[model samples]
Target: MKQSVTVEAGGARMPETTTPHHFVAGIGAGPANLSLAALAGRHLPERVVLFDRQSGPSWHSGMLGADARLQNSWIKDLVSLVDPCNRLSFLNYLVTTGRIFAFLNAQFTAVPRVEYARYLAWAAGELGTVHYGVDVVEVDFTDRFVVRGRNGAVATADHLVLGLGTRPRVPECFRSGTGLIEGAVLAEHLDAHLNRSEAPPAGQVIVVGGGQTGAEAVQCLIRRGYRDIRWLGRRHWFAPLDDSPPANDFYRPTYQKFFYQLPDEVRRSYLAEQAYTSDGISLDTLQEIYRANYEAFLRDGRAPVMLLPGRDVVRAGSTGGGLGLWCERGSGGRERHTAGLVVIATGREPAPMPLSAALHELVETDNAGEPLIEQDYSVRWKHSTAHKLFLQNRGRFTHGLADPNLSLLSVRSAMIVNSLADREAYTIRDEQVYTMWA
Candidate 1:
């Protein structure tokens, strides 16, 4: 069992026993909490800790394709947006690792996803507040919040921040057939599946989903020399991400503030209408796929990939020693395809909240049973005035498109830190907007 230290409070020595105490205890050491830990550690070193179930620092390690690149700019790192002077900035990482010159020489429009993952690991190592391999099971509130892991009570905190990121969303058609089918795999697990499979390079493969992940999966299959590949998507065309300046305005703090002031219905409707701003395939990646297809066609006189857009995979099953997929076409017809391997890259949903029954009862929820997140990302619960329970990446409905994107990571962290300390720890300034969102 872990032990605790005592300190003098109110002119008396308190007997602090085995469990550690902190001002804030965050669950999950993803970028969201890692950013918070980095900022909090500077001001309140050893006063904030993050618990993660993973054994080590990794961000979507399985999906780190050979050519996968970050959709956002490198400057939108963990600390630079709010506190560029902080020691854990991405620029500092490059300088410390002696890769600044080489990185600049490369002139990458978007840095590789693997490089960003390494930057996060480097920051996590510097902070040294993440407790890995500790699966925080339940969180209950009494005098303060008690965070219980598999071993027992890991720590207690005056406030809690849930950054339990997201999990890969499996379609209902593929859910039951996952283990029974030999070659079925989720996008996140494709790397592992490819490593161990004995399938031939000429095998037929199906890549489902229209977003970035789906495009990446198709590229991976083509690189692996898969001759017959079918790419299916629900959209009429494989739409490229709207990364123009005006589209990017939606990710700024000014637009976020304007969005938060709108009626709930309007905000929700806008999000539905503008999903492509954040969820579409990168233009570069789409171009690469097209160029690759054209080059291969010129050499072999046949294209390897068949782009089957406007089709939604509705049913899946096993057929003739392979996986069979049934898709509902946008033009009102049903189509079927059989492939030796099927990769599902649909999307992701927020991970389940790790609140105990009692604590969950105290927190107010919306009609969908999600916690009512406020403008500052704090949950509107019974004890919110006294003790806060903040959420990260769980406010797309409340905070707009910027909530899940990496563009405003530091800004969000600064907001949470200010809320926790009841004072401004980092100044958040957004000025001189060209567009009037009001």
Candidate 2:
């Protein structure tokens, strides 16, 4: 794949592109790109637009359970850390929509996930840079970045920012020759599946995965009055998040900077050690589930949720009445359980970068075949510094845990903006430094 070659426009051969049309072509309209757009509104000289595949903006709608609450604080919104005065701030959304007082009165320990989704939609509406319904299939580059959608070259940019969020991890057992196994559903689609159900399912309901999503699936089942429910997790027990002050230090901008400077071996170890801080279920959520179980126990002789934490579902098959699953227990041996329906609450991985073959050949990658991203989230490509490619929420390996997290969203955006603008567009100030990683 040569740098100077005919690029495909839809199916037709288009001439090679030379001049840049947009300053930055952001590939996803999620929170990360939204943060960049919010801060770059006045910073960049050229036009900056984000193209999303969705008909409109939505954040984790499938997993927005009725009782689901965010593990992180509300202040971790799109533009607060760097630009609190930005119109897209979560506080502004609450106040503008006349829910500020009500929100304050409710005194939620953590804001509801549904509310956060709504806030994202609101922010998307306010930010005029997003162009929805454009499914960017591939991105090609010649002299300038060419972002192509399902149709043709939708936009060209001097720089590219890829922020396509993660996708749900569907296990092999759930898939079949034709399609997904019968009566098997991913956690993201559980709500819609339940809604469309003609009646309450008979027999036991099994939810696999011990993370927050898994717990939520169990809670949803309990709320739906599923008396016999089996909750399985890989861990020995459901782990609660370490949200203490010391744990939170890892999420700070100062800490992010420190973590970026460390060697790969040290960084990998630190990431493994601090996984629970970002990955574990919230303590409050666990308490809620336990309380619900307590209530069910008091109301009936048996509880609805039977937590089998150490069991790993090894095999699954469609049975006469339901589905039969074999679990490998942590203690020892294997056991079989049947379920009317199965909800896979397994985790997610970073989405694939849709770079064209020519573009991919130019970008440097690590031994794992991942693009070698710098501290500022810029991809080390075989191109001029004036033209660059940036990554958002796709730099956890390079930028520490905070890279994929919402804690330093605005700060990250600010760094990207400053880098592109070649000036300090936003002052990223985190003066208080109690613990030093260096």
Candidate 3:
């Protein structure tokens, strides 16, 4: 027997005719929830569904550079880490699409970002459970959780999973008098700007930030024949990612379990101390930038990029036809630089959760107003024992650096599915780890 309920729809109270009640409704069909949907299909077929605002499958499409490679290995795909034999594995995609031999012969140290994006789209197509073009605005709870979009009740579910993901964090300097600067843009939007019929003048261009995105933006400008480009970083010197053996240990399930048992203060301190393990730029990317600059200098008798580290842009303003930047140097001196265009790659912060106010009050929160997630990735709430609110990518402080990184996406999804089923859905095994941190 099925229970019917009325909900607000199109400014009028009506009944939901299209979407049926689901066992679990995942918000944001990004890699996190896509991974969950893949695993859940094996055990809870036709029971789970995901809603995404985008019209179709895409992962960081705006920033997908032509030569950009994934920071993590290809093996750390949606299902391979947990169930290698799963039909949705990256290897399966390669073999099924007839690119396995070409991919193997290419001898890529790291797979291209575009290929991974396509692989995700392929997996999403096979699952057939994701609802596109549905923007979930408010998630509230009644007898069961109601997921509402602009039109009204989209679906109801016994449990909810938030893989909301992150958004670009624009700094205060870029937000003052006007909404957005005229000649400045985010790194993600650089491609569109570069593609315009009227190419930007070969003048001074500034890239602000020290991470991978910033390096990519600088490289993009150089490739586009922007000769006089300035790359600024707050760090003393640009650093490469620490993908060493011991650092890799921090991403394993064994380390995540140990990290969860520690006190809150200890976890915060550890994250701060080891931030570089995941945040640093790739060594290969840095080398590419250097090589490009060297080759350009040999041909033109002048370098394309000017690396300026230990300089933080404190304020920005327009200088009529150009942009003015005031930077604080490491030597306690202030410097000013002018550029025809500025690209901001400052980084990203967590996207704001879309829980309704009434429902948010029922969920327990930390002093910082973040949901108190347990070791199993379920948020502690009044109705948690019955209706769970599972979070992914938003558990960095609770779970370790691996929470946000791609290294542990499958493991995290498996933990959530097991918790939802109240049984071990997938057996997680981490054996012979050498590092012991207590």
Question: Cα deviation in Å at residue 184, candidate 3?
Answer: 1.3
Give me the candidate number with maximum lDDT.
3
| Candidate 2 accuracy as lDDT | 0.84
The lDDT for every candidate, in the order shown, is 0.86, 0.84, 0.88
User: Over the stretch 1-438, how does candidate 3's per-residue lDDT look in tens digits?
Assistant: 122322322354335555468888899988999999988865763456888888889899978887688989998999888899899999999999999999999999999999999999999898877778877899999888889888788788889999999988888988756556777888988988888728555778999999999998987887787899999999988889999988898899999999999999999999987888999999999999999989988999998899999999999988865999999999899999998889999999999998999999999999999999999999999999899999899889989999989999999999988988888989999999888797
How does candidate 1 fare on TM-score?
0.95
TM-score of 3: 0.95
Model 1 misplacement above 4 A: 1-17, 42-46, 177-182
Q: Rank the candidates by TM-score, best first.
A: 3, 1, 2
Clashing residue pairs, backbone N/CA/C < 3 A, model 1: none
**All models, RMSD in angstroms:** 4.5, 3.9, 2.6
Model 1 residue-pair collision total: 0
| CA displacement after TM-score superposition, residue 14 of candidate 1 (Å) | 19
Between prediction 2 and prediction 3, the one with superior lDDT is: 3
In model 2, the worst 10-residue window by lDDT is 1-10
- At residue 434, candidate 1 shows an lDDT of 92
Predicted structure 1: lDDT: 0.86
